[model samples]
Target: MTEGTDRPRIIEYAGNGFVITWEPARCRHAAECVRGLPTVFDNTRRPWIVTDGATVDEVVTVVDRCPSYALGYRTADGRWRSAPAGA
Candidate 1:
């Protein structure tokens, strides 16, 4: 926990299109992230998500591939979004 145990910044975007959340830790190295959008979710990287690495559109495209709720997205104005069920 070198960066501090408080938790990495969990980005939850409730936008005109979707309500999405991401928990980078529970990701389980599925690589769904990096595979879907290499520019944003690179394996040979730190701060792996690199949300800034891609545009919000690109990020959402990749995040949608996550099998775990480690990444999630849905219609924004339809249902309220949440962070990792219990989290």
Candidate 2:
């Protein structure tokens, strides 16, 4: 959960060109992220979401396929895209 709130936890992982956010509570384990880009979404690794593993465009493409909207991203250019409510 988020600090001082009952909302499910949303973790952020930042890289040089983008920032990725993940809401575990919203994940359906669709595997879109892992299958689309294993280097970036490897659950076997600690702090699994590694934004730097791929380019901003590549990351955004995969994140857009997340069926549950558990994955989201913000680009360095100030464009924000995330869960429906968060977006």
* lDDT tens readout by residue for model 1, 2-30: 66676655666444455556666766788
Check candidate 1 and list the clashing pairs.
Answer: none
lDDT of 1 at 53: 39
Error of 2 at 55 (Å): 0.6
- Which ten contiguous residues of candidate 1 have the minimum total lDDT? 76-85
Candidate with best TM-score: 2
Quote the positional error of residue 61 for candidate 1 in Å: 1.7
TM-score of each: 0.53, 0.85
Candidate 2 residue pairs in backbone clash? none
Clashes of each: 0, 0
lDDT of 1: 0.61
Candidate 2 structure quality by residue, lDDT tens digits, 1-87: 556666779999998789988999999998999999998999889978877658888888889999999988899988666777653
Highest lDDT: which candidate?
2
